[model samples]
Target: MASENVKLEPLGPNKTGPNRIQDDGIDDYDPHLHREVESPTTNAETLIHLLKGCLGTGILALPEAFKYSGMANGIVSTFLIGLLCTYCLHVLVRAQYVICKKLKVALLTYPESMKIACEIGPTCLRRFAPYAPAITNFFLIFYQLGICCVYIVFVGKNIKAVADEYTTNDISLTLYILMFFVPFVAIICIKNLKLLAPFSILANLITLVTFGVVGYYVCQNLPPFSSLPSFGTLFNYPLYFGTTLFSLQAVGVVIALENNMATPKQFRGAFGVLNIGMTLVTIIYVGMAMMGYWKYGDKIESSITLNFPPGDVLAKVIRIMYSIAIYISYGLQGYVPVQIIWSNYMAKSLDNSSRKSLYEYMLRIGCVVLTFLLAITVPLLGLFISLVGAFCLSALGIAFPAIIELCAYWPDRLGPGRWILWKDIGLIIVGIVGLCAGSYSCIYEIVRSLASGQT
Candidate 1:
């Protein structure tokens, strides 16, 4: 908690909204005012917190995604999409930083971040600014729930194997996963976002473990991956496309953290960290996907662990760890959007004449309920990725920041900097084009899968 005397600085009318505090320069921000919110840990703690939360349940499904996209193409696409995602997150970071600095109020909450930004310029722009976070949060809750459910399912399957009991096998795996929500709900009940930081750090470490586990098997199975050079896309391409997108989804998670960072000035260092982390992820994706598919060829399941001999203790152990890791990651991921909605609902309830205190509680219960429902209905893994990525993330992750940046800092502000403006507008335009076109292809593929009666 910050000191009550600590105040947010304000900006000119061009920056702050009509309702905002007038700038007097009297209330300078103590940039370190919120340091108590974090432990003595430095920006590395923040960076890892951002990266690990982003990587969540996606790790379990990434190899499967690669199989959907194809081999060479998927490997290539992983790096390409990661870079593009890094760019999108960078835009959001810039937008949030620029807006927050202008407003002088720290983005202590999600809505506070956006509201402060929109105050920088026009009214209509302000109105639209909140959409991205809202939509992102809506999808994230389900995404997180799905991951946790997967973890629960993994537990049941393993426990059933060991116990040699519970003979009733008629229940759906998804339903069994729902049963764990009683416990998961208890976990989500905790209110502090920063409190999850240590867990997120563990998630990143688990990610490293998963990477190493996969890498070890990959290296030992080197003969199969020798086919990389001969790999051509036309046929093997769709085999691994999905993982490319999965590899980069964490970058969107970065945007959620970027808004909450204590020091906006440290953004450059954060972006550098982000790029390096994504590069590592890309390499791991390429290594795992190329090796797994090349090894098994047509017999490969979406997940390599599945394709491994079932009774092998090593493989089972890896699968268990992998599943647990995804499960924890998703649980953390769910918190990102829930916190945003919870914050906004709390902020608005200040004058909405409603059950203000209860809204926060409602947010927790709603997350558990929604996630449980999703796990049951949309049991298919492919469908989950499509729904989360194309419908939710495409606009929120790809299109929204570009729109905000163009609207917030364009046309006049460049001051004869048409060259720079055109360059950015071109990049933004490219991202928008990619969003529409790529999302169409992904949705088309998902629709085709549904039509074909495939999961």
Candidate 2:
């Protein structure tokens, strides 16, 4: 799939003619026809990319997530969350198409879509239109950076786990994280998305192999359904909510993937790329969470890979190989924040400078260093995942899209009796509640862990 480098065309006058009109009054402005992709991806390729986006280090955390929500509740809740996320994605994409027709533009990025939606929305929100992009970008940057931090901690912990088995010396997780600083900086500096494509392909292969091995281990000697609890406490559900949200929602990449597709309209229907990919993703997540939790019961680690027996060479290889996969993924995850920061904020200021390239490299290094510092500072993988999910994904995945939809279709045509309005309001409420409750739960746990002098 193409990267976010696809340029957004300026809004032109709305076209109106027999050619531009469909049977319905809606304009026949097909964004796909206008998209100038150098190498557009087929539906199958786009589906694969979508799967990769949703399945990441987050998948390894689902088993731990299930530990908090329990067996039956986790399974049901994960499916529901996945369904909600997929619906939100559909709405966001649909809203973009609507706004794109109104604006007569080929495509828009997430933040760009938000900005335009607000600009053309109701009068009450028109004043805030200028700030919409900034707000959306803020959440996107936070979520992307959080993923990078998770990657850092994930890679460090797995590497530390494997190394601990080999020698008597005890190396700190922080040291392992620090050791990757140079390598992380080196890889991230590559900049070009094409240059990183091979690494991404390799990582995906390794991840699939790792998952296969993990599935084999977890499936063998499985515990009965009665072995684990049917449900967990109220407070723990927020942890489950956050982790599942983190695991299932790939809001950041949804627009880019859709924009780069050869058949963009095929991305949201019943049998389309979005539905098919997310269905598979949800099933894989549920299977992993249920099986991993059942196998380990209450003693499951934050990542399933950590649950593998230490004495086993195959387990060691799994850890090392999965870590390598995640290590490569760090660059891919970090690419978003770098693109947003550079293209939107920094590039303009340095457009005339002789050393613009030098400054861009510095920005890339700075981003890697920031995530490294954060990973070592917290290092609590579970809590960090929950916090990022609750705080960022809550807004990016659910709330923002609903808000954009409301603005995009305001004052008319919100379905019969304005059901769309009510529905969006409910979604916004759910997003807000999840944001507050889940974030508070994760923060409280982090503080308690720190207060008790636990790393």
lDDT of every predicted structure (CA atoms): 0.54, 0.86
Residue 227's lDDT within candidate 2 is: 78
Candidate 2 residue-wise lDDT, 159-249, digit = tens: 8988998889988889988988898898888878799888889999998999899898899888787979999999989999999999999
Task: Tell me the tens digit of each residue's lDDT in model 1 across 1-455.
Answer: 11212234553343345355333334455333422344233457556655555554455456556555656666777777777777777776666544444456554333344444454444566676556445445545444454544444444444333222336465545555655677667667767767766776665676677667666664565455544444444433332333345445654456544434555356445456566666666665566666766666555554455565556676666666665555455555556556556554455556674776576767777877776665554445544554455444555555556555554453345436556446556765654555555556555665676577664
True lDDT of residue 378, candidate 2: 91
Quote the lDDT for 43 in model 2.
95
Error of 2 at 176 (Å): 1.4
Backbone collisions counted per model:
16, 0
TM-score for each model: 0.74, 0.95
How many angstroms is residue 56 displaced in model 2 relative to the true structure, after the best TM-score fit?
Answer: 0.8
Residue 360 Cα positional deviation in candidate 1, in Å, after optimal superposition? 4.4
- Ten-residue region with minimum lDDT total, candidate 1: 1-10
